[model samples]
Target: MSKLEIHQIPVLNDNYLYLIKDPDSDAVAIVDPAVAEPVQEKLDELGWRLTHILNTHHHFDHTGANLELKEKTGCIIVGSKADADRIPGIDIQLEDGDIFEFGTQKARIFEVSGHTLGHIAYWFEGSDALFCGDTLFALGCGRLFEGTPAQMWHSLSKFLTLPDRTKVYCAHEYTEANARFALSVEPQNAALQQRFEDILALRAKGQPTVPSTLGEEKNTNPFLRPDSPDLQETLGMGGADLIDIFAETRARKDSF
Candidate 1:
């Protein structure tokens, strides 16, 4: 089996920054760091040298820790060129189809510009791991702050094409609340109900319900399943495209 370890660094409320490590090579990469202190402490504990700083968007909550962390480790900051002005100290501006090595594997960058104007997600194809930041979440998606409904639609559509087994590593711990909204939209969805129950059990024990696979999200995540006849009909917008359903679901959650 391939050796890939993903660490969740809880920072600033429920946000879960990630540390991607390769045991064999002892190389480490951090994704969407919101705070530097916690990440620095973890790196010291693991005795791992930071190699790359992978950012998903230009939001301060996501890239605020970039300069501080890079100052300490001298690691290169990688983010989308379109948002270069917003992301601090971005040394390497990445675009779609760009491939960069993290440790023992390489990550293919996909331009997922919905959550933010220049948002991008990293896919480590060899290990079937995805560092999606806020573009794709466990049971929800990021609020559309920059892009339009159509842009978000096309972006999520591309992600749904990835292999079902790919593990999704989102940047925050918003699963429980998102699941609640999901239940409202798809009341009879057995998969959604079962997942909500499972999450409740985990949280009841003070556990983190994250790193859900693409297959699980596909079955349960409403934002990703706009084509479901049940959900489409319930919204009173049957025959509407994925973008229409996505917009409606997002609007409902905004008020929820």
Candidate 2:
């Protein structure tokens, strides 16, 4: 299979809109476009027409451009079946484990609820790329807007089973702030400390710290490390259930 070309377009303060293209067939898909103008501009520049719009959830920041983009390009909008009523212009309703194709590329849907009950992520096995909207972030996870800590933990556990080399493409650029909060939780984590410094340097240069590998996040993201003894000890929750540890970590982050 030919390699897929992915472009990251920054919009609406910190949200990222991804434009993916299949080089073999020149088919294009845009993920979670917060606005239409910028996405349209990028599509014109790439000389690629949008054929699909993949929505991870029904949040405005993620689906605000769906209707406009669909009207403009006649692209089919794909989103979670659970949120069909909330997602605008949805053409395809996807359930967990459902597979869809964009040209030669195939993606499996994962219903990862936490940030939102119907939140879903797209995993492209061939490309080892995961488009996880707000459910998970680079160093942080999304706030519990409509789901419980246990639900979020269960959702996150699904991601942990993915290949370590999978590339994580979260929606927002909140890594720097998340790193600061992570340090307070596990100051002795050598890997987390190193990653914090690396993120600092990247942000200093006005660079993005996204597209981080799952392996790297496993080492550094506190939200994904409820099983870490150090973190559990820091939270004074040693021998606690993983769900309890996760809840405490998320609660601390809320105040941090």
Candidate 3:
């Protein structure tokens, strides 16, 4: 199978839009577009036709360009079956675990609904790539906008099943701020401390620190490291339930 070529397009204040391609078939798709002109410009620059719009959720920032892009390129909009009513110009409704195929390229769908009840992530197994919208971030998870902490925790657990090398293509550039909050949660985590410095350097150069490896996040992201004894101790919730550690960390992050 040909590798999936992904182009990261930073938009708005912190949102990221991805333009992906299946080289074998020259099929191209965009993930969670916030605006249309940038996508159109990128498509024109690459000379690749936009064939599909893969929306991870129904949030306005993620789906704002769906209708316009679909109308402009005649691209089919693919979204979660659970949010079919909310996604504008949706052409294909996918349930959790369904495979979205574009020629030889295929992605396994994961319903990771913490940010939104119907949010779905696309995992391209062949490419070892995960395009998780807001459910997961580089160093933080999305706020509990439409679901409970238990629900978000369950959604995050699904991601743990993927290989450690999986590249996390989350939907925003919130890593720096997340790193700061993570340090506040686990100030003594050596890996997190180093990661925090690394994040600072990256942002200093005006660089993007996205597409973080799942291993890196698991090691440093406070949300994913709720099981860490250090984090539990830091929160003074030693010997606590993992979910409690998670909830407390998330709650603190809300205030941090």
Candidate 4:
């Protein structure tokens, strides 16, 4: 079995910087190092050297520490080749459909480009793990900062196709607020209500909600269930097109 260890480096109040380690080879991979100091400290504490830095997008909060971390650890910084100019000092410029291995774990790159024009997500098929960045959140999706509604809809649809058991690691700890919104939309949804209570308790103890399974997300995340009657009705649009449903939800969340 492939060994996977995930570290959540809290940065900028709510952002999460993920460090994935393979014990067999002592290989390390970081997804979205928002800052250098904390990531550096965590790696030193764990005695793990970073081999690759996986970028989800070109946003400063996601890739700000890339150059500094690369310089400090001599690690390869990877991101969408199309975003090379935006994401500084990228070494491994990957495109959609690219597959590569880190130790015994292999990852497939998916161009989930709605969060940013060239955003990407990494999937470890063997581990059933997904580093989705800002594309799909615990119970929501990122605001449409760059891409169109249609683009975001398409990107989210791709994620919804993954196996329900896939573990999703997003870049932030917005689950509490997101679950609150989800409950508002699906008040009668037993799963959403239960999840809200569970996550509330988790946060109450000052814990981090990092990895959420795709099965749980499918059951409670309304953004991924635009076709569901509950979500469609909540948006006040009956039989609305997928793009419209996505747009409405995103608009509501921007103010939420």
Provide the lowest-lDDT 10-residue window in model 1: 1-10
Candidate 1 residue lDDT tens string, 1-256: 3657888888888988888887768678789888899998998898888977889998878988999889989988989988888899999888888997766688898888888888999998888888888889999999898888888878888788899999999988899999999999999899899999999999899788988999999999999989999899889889987788889988898899
lDDT of 1 at 79: 91
Off by over 4 Å in 1: none
Task: After superposing candidate 2 on the true structure, give the runs of residues whose Cα lies further than 4 Å from its correct spot.
Answer: none
lDDT of 3 by residue, 1-256 (tens): 8889999999999999999999899689999999999999999999999999999999999999999988888998999999999999998999888998976988999998878899999999899999999999999999999988888999999988899999999999999999999998899899999998899999999999999999998888889888888888889998988888888999999999
Top-down lDDT ranking: 2, 3, 1, 4
lDDT of 3 at 117: 93
RMSD to native, candidate 1: 1.3
Taking every candidate in turn, the Cα RMSD to the unseen true structure, in Å, is 1.3, 0.7, 0.8, 1.3
| Candidate-wise lDDT, in order | 0.88, 0.93, 0.92, 0.86
lDDT of 4 by residue, 140-253 (tens): 888888888899989888888889989999998999999988887778789999889899889999998768999999899988877878888877888978888878887888
Comparing candidate 1 with candidate 4, which one achieves the higher TM-score? 1
Model 2 lDDT per residue over 1-256, tens place: 9767999999988999899998888679999989999999998897889999999999999999999999988999999999999999998999998998888999999999999999999999888999999999998999999999999999999999999999999999999999999999989999999998999999999999998999998998899998999999899998999999999999999999
- Model 1 reaches what TM-score against the true structure? 0.96
TM-score for all models, in order of appearance:
0.96, 0.99, 0.98, 0.95
- Write down the TM-score for model 4: 0.95
